[model samples]
Target: MLDAHAWVCCDARMIQATATIRCAACILFLNGCAAPATSHDESRTASSASSPDNLSAATAIAHTRPLFDVMTFSQWQVVGGDARFELHALANPQESAAELTLVGRGPIPRNGFLVSPRELGDFTLTVDVRIGSAENPRAEAMNSGIQIRSRRMNVGQGNAAQWTIGGLQIEIDPSSRAWSGGVYEECGRAWLASLAENEAASAAFVLGGWNRYEIECIGPRIRTKVNGVAAAQWFDATVAGVLAFQVHGGASCEVAFKTPMLIEHGIHEWRALADEVSGSSGERCAWQSTIASTTRGVRLEIEGAARVDLLADDGARLASLSTSPEPKISAENKAKPSIVELLWMEGEGAALLDGVRVAQFACVTVPSRVRVLGESCAVLRAESLQRK
Candidate 1:
């Protein structure tokens, strides 16, 4: 029978959920409410979620992969320093929406974020944002942003203790100046790039209205847009982490987010996040990584988002590129099996593999050389790039 597990699965918009519904017609539970779902309701949900071409700005979001989850305050956890915030539903009368308001309380405060428990690698995230002014109405007042491929980290000690988020933040500054769509590293490196750096893009943000902010992160290269205009971009080699919404500190401020949606590729981490939810079946799909054997004893590391596994051939494991301590490779420790095949999951535009992207094939086997995607998101292969 459809139990509580089915209830949570239905929340993600994927409810072929493995649990048999005892009474699909008699009773339908959605977000803790009992309502009867009709044939038309079922058909519309199935079509919109599965059709790639059906996606549009109007109505509900349509995506290729089943939606991982909506960024509702229900599944998010407040992190960083001692920030105090309140999350509540924003009644739209006809549509589902929510808001996150921070009272801006805390000592030794730097910034606060509402981070999802799920770690994402490659995805497109969009949200409607309204930047609010702080108590004093200074530089920190007109600040709010969406943090993608980010992490929650704590630094300092004692009263100096600070809980801060480190990673890339899409800068949202709606003041006398226009730097809303710029890209800034929260606590790591300073600024990478911004619309303020570009003349024409700086005018993309429209004042005094709901602005749609989108972040397209494929591997290390990230492109941001404000109201559908290109704003800022930067490239790095690491591309995997949790997504978060920011409330900049320094003054008592309020920020609101509504209708957050995400489109993901190679979603191999949903089950882990589901396990944390109550009564979730935690459905999992298996994907194997193939070892591309070029030469003996040479190490090859494929770093993506979330958990990292050592790529191995025979019994010997390839050393990791990071200074992070070596991982113990055992049958029990690693989940997926390493095979003899090599394929890049999605295209460079949507996702990346081995830091190189080959656009010709949906998923190509280990090629001798491939082009690196450019700033324009075009795939370029260097043929000379041999895995050292």
Candidate 2:
């Protein structure tokens, strides 16, 4: 069974810019949900040096540590603002997956407030999220999440599962699917369709409060464990980069990160594809990001009727690159058309049709050092776009 405690302090609404108190147990809770208390003699590891600076109003409640207690300060940074804690309901309806509790209040507006930066690939990100307020007698249970490899968008998509950008999301809600601690590619991938099955321990561990969430990324394989139970495992070479957290709007929740760490490993070797394209369908060809001199370009060369769209890490539209006319001969022996390219820049975004019309063509410029991904719908075919 899990060991925990609860208490209500102030009944007044939490201030938006106020910072939260630090608790040692909350730190151990992040290390590993079931972790025992540490002794005074036990030496503490240093924190990441690269952890994000510049806290925002929301994240003011997030925890921080000195360099001496942890490892590289350069390791982890607050992706967005400081995580804030608030109360929404005391106990919400318990569903098939997990119960909802702890709603976040204040400065955490109803919508459109991004908490952090983009997160992708290999991370052991942990947060302490709860459902009640210190002062309430009994509040409705709330639901929250620790978003991994997440990208935020506009207000309209607040409740949508797809509005979330790419990367794995450890869902924190109670549903029959038990999506909690499972790896989900937001807006891009399907729901719990690619997860591992028959893991009783993993499923059982995720049923309670303040559970620890851990994500391990090596090459295309991703493993997620909740409280030491392997809840989900996903194998896809297409993902890489930072991490994030999700504070469901209108719900009361507080997120805290203690001794956050980011460690980089040497590149892993893998098979290289011969052609980036498959057939006429643009199903098999892969996407590539190349740097020519100072200009950065993202290319997709696929076979068949290839329909491609490029999007910024923040869910903003950039450009769509696709091939057409599709390389064929007409009855009159006329020439076919060329491929399509879309370009977009900061503030200004455009789609270029090239010789093709504006409707069929577009282009978006990929900024230097920014991460970009290529997406193809199920209608496109099963072509492999491998990234190195």
Candidate 3:
């Protein structure tokens, strides 16, 4: 049995393409990158923090004091069509991101996925996905998505494509303008609720790049956020099932998934942008993108009105229209400026403003602090925070 009180807000980060954590009613529900907690784990974390040599423990806790790390063919199975999986090269030359690419060389419109072994209920899930770049504007419909509370069963469709998964699907539509964060019921009624009108979130997903996806499942209410912007939320009764990352067959397109995290019974928006425009200055603003992950997804997008480029700590252009922001999708997903993070990624919040260098904001989870550039890097007053 699992204790209800032992919820550990953890970093459910994908250490490698294969390294994933699972929780049996144990976890932190932030950023969807959380794991289960156990008795005495807190004391172990405190002691391990002082000893850096315990990389294994530190690594586990670093992501989110998870009880079990699930990897390998034993913990995962490939479903839906004959697709291949391998740890391949990353698009960004500078990042050593652990990503599993699903190369679909089989039939078109093939829906393949790596399904987890365990079935979970009432949890938050998040993942970063990068679809194959389209050669032109009229690109083939290379689609991908994350499955929630789903189950695998052999459909009547014989051969390698016989296995079918059914449940709720968090759609990742690179081709459609407003279909990224929308939720659809698989093998059942379709299109539960759409984010078609949410222009900000619909525009949040950039084509041919990494995009962050957050899914919160609590009771009958399921909310989804894309790139820290609240996309959609609705109610349903089908509670518990396995999780899967899908590589929907498309126009000879390959898909990659990284930073897949799960927390039992919670939510985190650790990477959400806090303050974009300064209160008094109002001269600058910020933009959050998977490309901002280099600096943990916090980049300064100077206000167009300012018309002045911002420099980094080394005096290089940091925030400019022509800078062509680097491809950064924080191993931990980040929220946008307008996000009302229920409990940001592991209960921490991040913000990027018009600052120079690869530095902008620093956040501490315990006694959560938000820091911004002012004279020197100082702690922003926590007047609104309450101590229990």
- Model 2 agreement with the true structure over 1-388: per-residue lDDT tens digits: 1122322223332212222222211111111111123221110111122223221211111233221122221122222222333222113242111221223332333311223332333334433433334553222344445555444432234452222223456666443445556666554554542234645633653333455656655444456666666776544434343354455445444432322333333222223222233332433433333222222223223333554555444534454544553555568897444333332222233333332224322224443321212244222122222222
Q: What is candidate 1's lDDT per residue for 239-288, written digit by digit as tens?
A: 56777767676655456565566776432111111111111124221122
**Alpha-carbon error at 282 in model 2, in Å?**
23
Query: Per-residue alpha-carbon lDDT of model 3 for 1-388, expressed as tens digits?
Result: 2112112223542222222222211121111111233223332233223322211221111232121233333335456644544333335443222322333222345676766655565576666767664542333366767788777654654353255677889888887665888988777767776777788888888677778888887544578998899987654434456677676664565665654555665221113344433432542232221222122122222212222233333334433322212322345774222111111122222222222122222223222122133221222211121111
Query: lDDT: which is higher, 1 or 2?
Result: 1
Off by over 4 Å in 2: 1-121, 126-141, 152-167, 174-177, 193-203, 206-208, 254-262, 266-301, 305-388
Better of 1 and 2 by TM-score: 1
lDDT of each: 0.45, 0.35, 0.46
Better of 1 and 3 by TM-score: 1
Best by TM-score: 1
Steric clashes per prediction: 5, 89, 32
